[model samples]
Target: MTETDIPALLALRDNPPFEKMHTVAISGMGPVGMVAALRLAQLGHDVIVFEALGGLSAEARASTFHPSSLELLEQLGVVEELHAVGLKAPIYQYRERSGAVLSQMDMTLLEGETAYPYRLQSEQNNLTEIILGKLQDMPNVTLRFNSPVARVERGDRHVRIHLEGGHRDEPILAQWMIACDGAASPTRKSLGIAFEGTTYDDRFLVISTTHEFREDLGEDLAYVSYIYDPTEWGVLLRTPNHWRALFPVTDAETDEEVMSAENMEARMQRLNPKDTPYEIVHRNVYAVNMRSASTYASGQVLLAGDAAHCNNPLGGMGMNSGIHDAWAAVECINAVLTEGVDATHAATLYSELRRDAAINHVQARAQKNYDNMRQDDDAARAEQADQLSAMDRDLFEKREHQRNSAMFTSLRLTLGRLKRELHAVKAPAVSGGQKFSKLLGQGPVYAAGAYDAVSAKLVEQAGFKAVYVPGSAVSASVMGQPDLGYIGLAEMAEAVRRITAATDLPVIVDGDTGYGGVLQAAEAVRRLEQVGAAGIQFEDQLAPKRCGHLAGKALVETEEMVAKVKIAVAERTSAVIIARTDAKGVEGFEGALARAAAYAEAGADLVFAEGVYSLEELTALRDAVRTVVGGRPLMVNLSEAGDSSALPPLELAHEAGVGFLIHPVSAVLAAAEGIAATYQRLLTTGASGKGQEDWKQFTTLLRQDEQLERASRLAAGEA
Candidate 1:
């Protein structure tokens, strides 16, 4: 049915009396706040929306609303109005730089899963206006433009909002307050909650034109397209009135150079090569950030939308997630007020659910979207294209992909968490240390090295017992540098956290020289344990230590190394501590055995005799350490190109009495080789050597279908 003829859908039902209802003060008049205010007013609560701006913005921002967001808008009674004005896009495409479509995603795969099976292309301002018009008719809704909140004071029963230049001279009071005040929220700052994450080095230039891109380029063009070009990756989206192109500008180019009339014209011409200069309607340059508030609630004040989390606009998830946050926050607030649930408890649950969604779903997805388009490596880009094409050809895979891209999975997960909370059902917790210990008890354990979460997932899929997070691998992959003690404890721990979060396998991290002396070692152990590390290996090397295989490495005194091991053992709760002695390369095998015995005496769970080159050397060292330390578990490094290059195979090492065998760089080396080959093929042939079937098999191994099943169960409230 046409949206203009859907009056029945837009009609509001009768609600409870508002005379005895409490008031809610919302600190922003953006789309999120407007939706929240309208929903609360519909539920018979008085709501006041305060906007710092004089009026709504005409600028283009966040133009795509996902299916999950459309469902919420439907609940708020504005979906019909939105449909009347906005454009519905059933497909989106990924294209090459020359405008050749490489892959296309059909949103129809989500037909049965969501009421609105396609994304809606509508400006943020359009939504705000429609919501405002409906709110003006409701007596319980009051919107005050140009009213900015200065500071908020939370009380026992209410919240006091001090205005900077509000409609009334006196402070405003409400039973609850919501801050939807954008990324740099004053309310969030006043509450002293940290907005933590990274900002992109490149700024995005959003240019809108009335010119018809589809007419010039082909009628087959989707409403939205991401063009992948190593030099100039950009995105194109069609609005009701205009088409917008988003281009990335690096710091190397000055703002004046990027925004100059000639440069802008040149960019448009390159996009389509039209004779006439593209008529510009609006243009804006803004920095994109991936940041989230540490907590979504502070006392009586709660944060929603951009105030709670902000991300790059690559995947069009920011606005949709914000709208979801609005509904969730209002629901939690309603539960507290009407259902007699404790306010603090409700707020805490809301914070946990929304914060996790923002971080894991919105931010992570947006970042990956940006990365996929902006990948500089030809081979990686081709591989990504192959994977997308594979998804396009497979029904189940496409449905799974649609679930994530359409934001249905995130909403389902959030609802599942809420359901579990309400039902008082707890999920089983998996302890990293316990898993590692279980594997250790089952005989010889071999761990594959991983530098990032993706690699860790590959290792887990390969059925590895554990993941070894080597310091050298982390330094090279994360920091793009050599592993000469350039990374600190915090950076390494964060990497460990990401890897551990991505896979269920136990992760053992490399703690280089424990980052410092005994105190630093203790703190490092504490931090690693907090991040769910299963084990940490500290080498007996001086500060600024080089890789064990590298030349010119120095060792710390045996007593000093023993002290650090003792401190690590004392500080960690359940994490296994492996003390690595590098004395074999410096002070010979006997000295290394002595240092190992000392570390064992200091309560080290495992002893690694680093730099053992040959089988004879390994066996002698292991026998001597066993004699000295009474059969303490020993770890052997079986590198393909490092100091242990001459070591025997895995079975041989196991037979030679090695409890743990780590191939620290084999995974990284294999990745480097595969990537180089793929890039070479793409550069030479302009096609990926890996076919669609190969990509389908690879993605299946990644368990994309299993993930979709879980999301489906959660959405059905079965999880």
Candidate 2:
């Protein structure tokens, strides 16, 4: 077949030996970790859960569930079952110590707008048990107590986990590791991620009693009532046949003084009055702290649940936020396992999204809730409580504002900004010869306002192929050839497979002198052919080659390169083997030309006379190739420094007899120029806000007639 008529290359497919997960280890078995493991096992992946605690324990933590989180649980197919067991509290009452109800929130008003309008008041441990039941049913899931990962090791292909189980002193190896451990996690400590934040000075001495004051309350037993008086302020949450009450206690308060059953009964008597009859069931104490890890991912180790971020339970966001992290991690892991996007970057994105969400939305709101509770000065605290009460009332009853008060309004606005920030795409950096192609495709076009998708469309619109190198492009790197011998033999094979799948271009892959000496070069060439690469190029530079523009650049001996070229040509099955000479600028034009001629005589399919500085040099090299090999193809580097200013593509094809031109630095120039222009504009304005109106216009551009007209014209192919 003719060269232009060569068959269309199909995408390269990988059949990884570790195709299915057999033993998956999760470091934490908290609510998020437990739920995630259950979901993974439900999807048929063998799952192992490790918890520091020997068994599950009851805790009155994170009791309020948001409507969004409930919806998520429903999606996981567990919320309906959980809802059946938990009390759906539909209203919150704010009252003064004097027994006057200041304001009340009616969550039932949220009906029709959400599937679950009322917040569920089940203890977090109960929710954990619910998830545990679903997890236990999965045949592939194993729950191990008193077992934790000691360390983690990762390779290009798989991650090895070091496990310290309760029964065994020795460590066990697992295929993959997930650190879902809680806040103050050993796994996070091992990963070297910094947890940053402060613990509140206040703590809660929680008392559970079979309190029958529901009738004196004159409210639904499910209602969560907050006492607004500074000295007597606390929460009254109802559970089955028992009332779990939390009263704020200063850190200075002794545990003996706070935990005394007599003191607790007196506190309850002072708040509920009429000497309310009750039966104390259980009691505990907990401190509230809010912190965020500096990073969520370090190589193969990942942070999930409380290990990543901890929030105050005032707003009941702690466990709920952890659940969100679990969901986000699942999506990220799926992307890495299915798509070729780098695993590290994917993990980083997961951390960024989850951490930001918790810090900005959950933690901040929880702090506001704390402020409403712990403000000093009785009169000022009362005023703040009254405001919170009024806001809650307005939020529940005021339908015109969507029943949204200042709190919910700020929440919506914050969440809106978060969504916009999360959706913003960042353009990447490019350098070296790769910059040529980037500039040609994106620099000018993106300056004219085209990004990756638009730039690709522009290429398709201009009827040209748009190829991308996974990493930044280096000079003399092979285009179509597979195998990176400099890194490793196994890595070389994978790189070859990736390039095959990446593009259908006659891949001009740089073999860096065929992955070593002549024998290695021959074997690498054979592997490249087996992987379906169209061609391989061997550079004239000596081993451990540095960039051409750098100092102390060295060249391989001309005869040695010729020998490698001969070996490469003999080993290839259906691939072209091009020999490159990086000798033009290093040694004068004569040395480069002579090397090209020798390579051609040595049966090289194509010869590259790199660093040709002038049209005169290119002309001489072209003529020399004609003398030796007649009309064999010749590759040229159309660099800016090459002094080929007016040598357009058609002109080069017609006048120079050059078969290919590698304009690698074009995109890099365009990107750097655009970024610099933006920086300069920002400096001129003394701020980065002027173009915001334009950005808003672009974001909401459909409302503008001019934009709509342009869009319509573009849609109609009139642009």
Candidate 3:
């Protein structure tokens, strides 16, 4: 208000004082913001945390901490305090409105998979408060409450952070800044980043009461239960103090009308009637929106937690993903600050990892949960229930548990992808697509056929370069039919999924003639890539395509096949596209070679002329195709059923310039022979060869190794 103060402020704006410089200035002091602050302080970065609110927010939100969150909290040394006050909910249920338990999940099965196998049910504020306590004594940390960010300006070398509450004379200059502000981030808006997605028509209501559901719902009730009713689907969760229930309130009712005393009581009674008024602990109505920023980073400033993305909290992935984002942000920031990485490069890496986890995993799963919980179709509901209930088998249980616990999507897969992309650590384990992409230039890669997990594992154990999952073998094994396109996209994808999960080897899946057209072929490319196919081979044959070696196989027009190949290339996400032509059988050698060349021009990574006759012809075909494709690579499948069976030896084919050779039905044929012999001997002499594997070997292949190793350490007093 004074002339002297105006001049001082103008001077301050021009050049921030030395006292205002910090290593990092973070906006917001919520859970995500605090986690970043804690990590930065631990790493010796001078940190200043700004909170718009007076102190910690005590809103009744996000009480579930997943297994992966527990591990992360443990690393920060605050998990034990969380465990002390929180309830360990290891069992969650899915049920019908009539109280029929459709499915129940037991988290104890994850004992060996994670240290803390249960979800910790405590308010998120508890963890933030614990972190605050840890940060209070650190010399490098400053926690500023009620200090709203006035504006943020990104400069080339440093970011300027202006505080709103009585800090006009001071603007902090930070080496970098991270915005952990909540969903309605003005910072993101100021940077002109779009938060793009949909807002639901229904507003969700959360009513917490001391009224116990466990006492009324009987002994079979789980601490966490999702009750499905098309008209009034709801989620019931038992926190330490109260049973919290979430229900969707239609937009027909205004917020006040929906939250009226009469409406509230009636809703509670409708869910479970009580003779008296329910003891209400807390209630809130919030709009649910599934939205993510176009990009999480804007120049020198980065966004994390709810600032980067927010979604409907149906799957409890909201706060959990935010915390995961915090971890990721800190890691990326560490690279910039300590590892001498360029700031822009590190910021982009953070944006890709967190934004991907949000859009692909968190946002997608949450929307799916909302849809499934309120599913109206009777048959679809029944099928969903059956699928959930059917996750009782050990393999199914492990996979389901990992997915539900947020271990696979949020941590293992997403984080593994980040590590691989960074290539900063000794992290060899990466996404299969990356591994397969790296293997292309290396010559003479041979792939052995595998129809199942055991066969795929055996392929890896036998020192093969890759695993070849041919459609013919999958159709014969899974559907008991020849590869005449009887096996659909779903069936093939599932087989590919199982094989990819079973082995670390790059898998080349056979996509028989795209399954339909350019669009269907594009979908096939997406689905197969999703299930971890490193390379997908599509052949140039007409619908109901017979095996490539078969005589009755019809060839599609050369231009059409070329179009399909181009679509496959465009649709793929790092998967090698191999184009096969069965024209050698139908058309002559020159025709086949010409089609192959056309396909290569259409952007196929590998060219395959399916039925080449002799070694001399094959050699000439290889040289011609290689030259035409500019020496990318060529593929060949050596199966006894194929026309090339007469030209037997694999060594000679490699010498003929085959870059990738697949032993397409060899394992299936050998397995059939061995199994048939065992069955005959058992029928005749009453004894099966190797009557079941020794139980010990089976256990060793799975979860027993880590537990046994820990036990040995305990026994030896390794400390």
- All-Cα superposition RMSD per candidate: 29.3, 20.1, 25.8
Measured with C-alpha atoms, the lDDT of residue 430 in candidate 1 is: 43
TM-score versus the correct structure, for each prediction: 0.56, 0.55, 0.57
Worst 10 residues of 1 by lDDT: 12-21
> After superposition, which runs of candidate 2 have C-alpha atoms over 4 Å from their true positions?
1-24, 42-46, 153-158, 165-178, 220-222, 274-278, 339-342, 382-386, 389-719
Candidate with more favorable, higher TM-score: 1 or 2: 1
Clashes of 3: 0
Order of candidate numbers by lDDT, starting with the best: 1, 3, 2
lDDT of 2 at 305: 75
Per-residue lDDT tens digits for candidate 3, residues 1-719, read 11223234334323333324467888988888988899888888889899999998988898989998888888888899988879998888888888888877787777887898788899888888899899999988988898888778776446767777557334566767889889998778778889999899999999999998767789778888888889899999988889998989998999999888888888888988768888888999999889999999888788988988999877688888888888887877777667666667778888987888898888878888888899999999888877776775556665575565554556666577766765343323355665564454323566789988888987888777689998998999999998788988899899999998988899999999989988989999999999999999898899989988777878899999999999999998778888998988888888887887788788887887576557676677665653311122567766677655466354455456556666789899999998899899999989885734655665555547788899999999994
Clashes (candidate 2): 26
Candidate 1 ranges with C-alpha deviation above 4 Å:
1-22, 166-169, 423-719
Q: How does candidate 3 score on lDDT? A: 0.79
By lDDT, the best candidate is: 1
lDDT head-to-head 1 vs 2, winner = 1
Candidates by TM-score, descending order:
3, 1, 2
Q: List the global CA lDDT of all models.
A: 0.81, 0.60, 0.79
Model 1 steric clash total? 0
RMSD of 2: 20.1
Q: What's model 1's lDDT at 712?
A: 97
